[model samples]
Target: MPRRPISPQLLARQALALLIGYASARVALWLYLPLPWMLGPMFGCTVAALAGAPISGPNQLRMIVIPIIGVLLGSAITLPVLLSMPGWWPAFLVLAPFLLAALAGSYVVFRRLGGFDRSTAFFSAMPGGLNDAMLLGAAAGGDERRIALAHATRILVVVFLIPLFFSLVYGATGSAGGGNPARNVALSALSLSDWAILTAAAALGYWGGKKLDLPAYAVMGPMIVSGAAHVAGIVHVAPPTQLVNLAQLVIGVVIGCRFLGTTFREVSREMAVAGASAAVMIVIALAFAVPVAAIMQMPATQAFLAFSPGGLAEMSLLALSMGEDLAFVSVMHLTRIALVVAMARPIWRWVARRGEKDGA
Candidate 1:
């Protein structure tokens, strides 16, 4: 299918948004804030949208950047990381229970406190797979707008809070590509052959992932291919720091732009509900993360990130910034999204049936 032609007006809006995002990033960097490239733009654009600016993120452009991030993540993988995969089973083992607990807790908050109906509350409280929740919630006769807003608010809050928590509490600070000197290669240092291989990995992996109907395939597919190449010793360096930072900037802009076309007053109550539910989920994540970290012999912060209810990409970016185990964090989030997408509908149906039986 051919692509739709973007109107000139839309282009102008995107440009304005990007400009604001860039300026915000500069201010954040000057203030020595963590993950400035991402958080700065996210906060800036969000405020702009709330203030009624004619701004919109360039989502199409962000898609083009996502593959680069996938490749960058793949570069973090190696023989040792691959070998350590088996040891991660304990973390995986607890994931289902943690998810269930998170769902139940958030459901109570949304349904009872927020006064949302069963379908809307259930879907709104889902911890991951925002797009899936919106689709399934709408199909289940829920308010799609409310579901979307809830998930978006949760994501916005989680993404905004996690990095700040790490930075202030743990004193963590670094660029999104991480602090490993070896991985921070300059763009000019790459050979033409390296560029060719990376490009192919991004293009082919994205196509293959989409063909297989994988969730978040745009990033996951490229990460898989890039990871394989790195493990096989086919690639020796990560994508340049410049490229990674650019990807972060674009992602932040997209996140902030989610609030476009809506004002704070309009969504204030829903945002409060979603924000409270998000807090509930985060506390649950922390409870799981502490024990998992002890068992995994990793930092609690890393484990917390792995279990956080933020978007996969956002958490992965945080992992990169914190110099944590990117592979582990990415895999954990990917698993959560996959499980949610696969099981959410069936579970919702079962719950609905139980509710009906109880009422009868």
Candidate 2:
């Protein structure tokens, strides 16, 4: 069956919804500077959506912006960043068990407390992006909507809570929040040649990534291409802050829109479960991050973000702002995503089938 072209009315609705989401995020920036735009709209849209508002999230816009995000991620991968990685070996050794522990622990929270079905709970508890969780879970017959909401709430909680903990508990004082908060490049500094190369990388990398069937290929593909460019010293700067923020705005809108028809009662009920699951993972991550930091003789702040189950790009950017090692954090995030994507589906399927057999 052929998929019908999107209707103009629906497109318009989506646009309006995104505008609302973007506005909400902008307002949120007053409270939290680091991820104000993304987090704010995400919360607002979830509320508006659950209330049965006519607005929608920015899914269509995300397809375009994700590539730009990939390009930004790529620009962070300089040759010097690569050389600064030998000290990270200890943490990498611990990442495997950390992934499994987080997954297993969260799965129990969803299944037992949230009352999710086997497949939905399994995928819901995964620490991957909302898009990845939904696609993977739906492929294995999980409730797509439930999985989407679960993952969305997970990200919202994790991103917000991690920073708050740092600020309130640790008394960390940084001008810009997260990773190595670098100076921003004015949009005016970008030359035509710069535009040409970046656009080409995004375009080509997205196409190639899709062809290769890679996870988050649009972002990862360009990351590879752009990372190569910067590593080779062909480019020295990331995408402009203006553009990167735009990417975040659209992505947040899309995430918020995923809850368009869910009721507030339902979202609230599940959110409690999601929040608990995320909290559990945070506790576990913190426990491991300390030892890993001590063993590696690195800062605790850097190790925490590296182990944190936030989005790869979000965590990387946070690391950048917090004045941490961007390359090391990026590498850790990439490793976590790859490991989750590779293992999540197969493990869930095995568990689902086993449960079915036991019931029969």
Candidate 3:
């Protein structure tokens, strides 16, 4: 179980890619754009990778970077953030139907239009759980590689583009992790003891997350711990803006490197199908947000953020950046992940069995 030696050339390539991405993010931030730290780095490395750069991301770097993101997200929560949870219960009612609709729309695009195999189409149509989708798809005799790539593309596209939509809606009044107009941000203002306590929380939380097998535990564990500490009034500090931006940049590079080994011709059709499915899900989320938001007496923006088809970490960070309700956003995304895990695998197996019987 010893780790393989990483090539120095690979490390150098990754560094160059990150430098390009980070530089690009700085320029974008200077221009006062939304999600500048993440968006620019992601797309910057994506272009470099697509143009046939022999580059891979430093996964170890992301492991460190992602947890910082978790800490930042956690600090957003306070007693007040948890107090706002009761108002968000109604939004969960909209999630089940929204999920069904997303599955149906994705099925149509992947199956009928794209001509993917039934199993691939079915599992790929699912709106969440990339790891589960890929594994279940493979177990059902579908193309696991295609499923993985499809999801990687879907998540990358969703996280990368959704912010722009928000930007146009919310305007650029807010900024990244530092000087947040919203309370509960900026790790730099903390004292030495505060840092010690927060980092201690992070380490313990990570251990607990791993023990519990939480999705994206590195981020989630620290987040839960940090949020708890803040809610308990144990600490008032958040992760520093410099640290937050660095985390975002490295994460952007990780996402961008997802495209490194594949050619456009190979993944283009799958990407198209996946992107279409994601686009359909986005529409469905937005469509459901309006009436639900009215009924729930919440902002349409809040509803949309809850329903958005992005990862928990990315969306939570997005909500934080735009000065939206982070607690509701984080919880809904967590619920969505749970829903997908409990439902997607069994549903795929049933469909796969049904397809086999029909084909006979």
Off by over 4 Å in 1: 175-182
Give candidate 2 regions above 4 Å deviation: 1-5, 129-132, 173-181, 349-360
Candidate with maximal lDDT: 1
Model 3 clashes, total count = 0
Ranking by lDDT: 1, 2, 3
Model 2 per-residue lDDT tens digits across residues 238-353 = 77777777776777676677777778776788889988999989988998899999998888988999999888766766666666776688778888888898888688778878
What's the count of clashing pairs in each model shown?
0, 17, 0
Taking all chains together, each candidate's TM-score versus the true structure is 0.96, 0.90, 0.92
Clashing pairs in 1: none
lDDT of 3 at 228: 89
- CA lDDT, every model vs. true structure: 0.88, 0.79, 0.78
Q: All predictions: root-mean-square deviation over Cα?
A: 1.6, 2.6, 2.2
lDDT for predicted candidate 2 compared with the true structure: 0.79
